[model samples]
Each structure stands twice: as structure tokens, then as C-alpha cells.
Target: MFERYLAALEYPSQGGINIDDPKEFRNIVLWLEDQKIRHYTIEDRANLRKTGSATDWDPAYAKYKIDLGFPANLKSKTEELTWLFLYAIKLEYSDNADRYRSITAAQKIEQEKKSSAAPEIKSTNPFDKLDFTSPDFEEGSRKLAEKLGIAYHPDHLVSLRAASYVISTALNKEVLKEPIITGKPFPIDEGIGMGFENHQDLEKAARILRLLQIQNLRKLQTAINETIVAVQNITADPRTDTSLGKVGMK
Candidate 1:
């Protein structure tokens, strides 16, 4: 079924369709949605819990996990790369939503505060509002440091440097096509434990992480947009440069 879907999108033989093509991409998205619905119908029945049962009928959430793996499989394919492409757009939307909520919350807080201190800057840019206290940021930073053979410290300058490197790399590859390096393992330290040093540190860390997430998301959107433009140029005329140099040079 997945192969048939890819064939409909003209994968491989036609150098595959661009993820930015709204009409074509929407078809692919709808197909995915339909598949997900079908999968949920089957999985839900298999895992349905009894009214008074202490244990789930299907252990380990196998049904949902199996269904989720289909998307992951699509993401792993090189020839059928639309999954990651579409996934990036979804992430960009989520990040935008988060940024909006954060801004709204900040505005409310500012309005409630009666202190004489000057008003704080409220940036819509996601990177500017990263919160390092977030588990994602801390975990990502620690894992990255460990991978790079650097020691991980929660509040240390080195940890921040490591996080910046990790965040930059992820953004460059997953978000921006101008990746500094390719085929590198994501910097994540699974061994690092999670706990807050203090309330101040936690707040500061969360802010930093939020900023990084937003920046990364923005980069992804930009890269996707560039891909769309390149595809449009090619569709207009086949003589256009389709080489990696042209596509990558931007």
C-alpha cells in the first residue's frame, strides 16, 4: 500500500515530487491520514481494555507502536522521502503555534505585573525564547556533549556551548539544507539524569531551549520553502540545473 502511494506520487523514476507542492502534497497527506484512521480502527479493537481490568489487553501498546512505525519507516526511505518533508512542515506549524501561545502568555504576565521595571522584550522568534529548563533541551544538550566527548554540566558554560552546537547541527540538517556536516549522529546524551538545580536555573534553561526550538523550526520552514521554489523552477523548464550543486548552493 505504501509503495503504491509512492508510485502515485511519481517517486524514483521522476526524481520524486517536491514536498512543497501543495496540491500533490495534500494528496499524500490525505492518504497518510486515511491510513492512520484505518490503523487506529484495527489497533483500538485489539487493545481495548475491559471495564474493571487492572492490565491492558494488549501490553506495550503494540498496536499504536506498530501503527506509528509505518511513518518512521517512510521517513527512513531515501527514494520515498516525502514523509520527512511533510513531517518537517507539521513541526514548523507546531512551533509557530507554541510561539503564539508563549507570546500571549508573556503579554498577560506583563499586563498583570505592576512593578516599575521596564517592559521586557517579547520576541516572536522561537529561538529568542528558549527555556533551558525543558527536559528536551537538557537531554539534547547532555547527549550532544557526550557524543562529542565533552563533559556535561547542567548550568555550566560548557553545557551551553554544547547545546548551541547540538541545536545548530539539528537545525542545519533537519531545518536548513546548508548543513555544516552531513551523516553525523545527533548529539544526545541519554545517560544524563533530569533534575533542576534551582528555580532560577530551571527558568533560564527553559528559555534557552525554547529559543533553540524556534530557531530550528524556522530554519526547517525556510529549507522547505527553498525546495518548493527549486521544484517550481524545474517544472517550468526542464533545462534548469538539477544538480546537487545548484539545489544546495541556494
Candidate 2:
């Protein structure tokens, strides 16, 4: 189902496409229109029109998510399938999906085996080596921070300092907006709190924000999966087998 779209994406005539390029963007738009005629059945003119205020890819997706319990009709099943194909193709062609496919099945199995046999490795934080706590580094940091125009409070966390440097670099490259940092004397989190602010180039800021959001979402999903397994293990009896086949020691 995703083959056609994925093929076009992975093997464009240019070998790759710059979406920012006008020719490339127009080519993709034409390809999608052509695909509709050749492969799928998106006959609805309203669906094809992007000028509308109400409906588009994101809106339709949100609608489908909320109306999940609604039964599909025999007549519109074809249309639904076409939409599904489009959604699946887009998802499968994304960076997230590419990352998911990075490891082969054999590599995964080998990794699992190694993980089971090897000693547990403590996760290392990248900020650990960025020791901004030292007094000697403070003066140099101040001078650099002043040059860059990014907010750099001496009391800020090392993690935050590193982030500031990254933002500063982005600001220097883009030269679009100043990086702003808002801090408060919170009761927790080392008594200083920080968060994302709308204080940089919109596109770049959105990209980084989305990346962080995706990371948090992945962590939340992992926590939920682990919690489910832990609950089942604790509650399930080893001697019995249910429709699920087995649980706990069983």
C-alpha cells in the first residue's frame, strides 16, 4: 500500500528532493495528483481542495481519531482505505519510521541476547561532562554569552547552559531572532525552573520543540508498557493459563 509513495520519496528523479525548492515541491504535488488517478480513488472534490478552512490532512486525522468507535460503511470503505493508505505511506516515509527500521531483525535479537547476558550499563547524561559549576569556567562563559547575546545566568543549571549555547548557535546562523530564557525561583527542580519559550526562529524552534515532544511521548509510552507488564506479573498466577496463553512465571 505504501510502496508507490515510499518509492517516489526514496528515489526521486533528483535522487532526493529539497522540499524547500519550488520545482521539487511542484513535482511532488503533481506526483500526488497523478497517483490519485493511477492508484487510489479519491474522487471527492472537497477532499482534494486544500483552500477550505475546515478540512485537510491534520483535521481529517483528528476527526478519525475521535470517531474511532463509529462503524465503517460498505459504500465509503474504499474511500476510507484510500485515506488510510495515504496516512500509512506518509508515516512510513518519515524520520521516525526510518529510525524504527534502523536495526535489522537479527541485530535486534543479538542486541536482546547481549542485553540479557551483559551487566547493566548506567545511562550517561550528556550534560555530566559540561561542568559549568567550576568557578574558572564562569568568566569565559560570561564573555562568550555576552558576545552571543543569549541569556546566561551564572546560577543556571549546566544542562540549561548547554541548551543556551545551542540556541545561541542557531540564532547566530539564522540571525532572525534573539534567544530568550525565562527562569523562576521554583520550589523544586533545584529551586530554578526553565521551559521552552517562543523565543527563536519559528521554524527551527518548532523543529526542536517537536523533537523534545516526541522524546517525552516515547518515554511516556515506554513507562506505560513497563507498568502494564509489571502489573500483569504481580497480579497473574503462574500455575494458570488464560486466553492470553500465560502470565508471570508461566
Off by over 4 Å in 1: 1-198, 238-250
How would you encode candidate 1's per-residue C-alpha lDDT over 1-250 as one tens digit per residue? 4443454333343445445554444344334433322334543543332312326532423344355454544442333444533443454446466655556657756854655467788789997787767888777777777776677785645687866776676655666765466586644323332354357567556666766797899999999999999978876674666763344333
Model 1: number of backbone collisions? 24
**Model 1 worst lDDT run, 10 consecutive residues:** 45-54
TM-score per prediction, in order, is 0.21, 0.22
Q: CA lDDT of 128 in candidate 1? A: 73
Which candidate should be chosen as best, given lDDT against the real structure? Answer: 1
Q: How many residue pairs clash in each candidate?
A: 24, 0
- Global fold similarity of model 1 (TM-score): 0.21
Please give the lDDT score for candidate 2: 0.53
Worst 10 residues of 2 by lDDT: 187-196
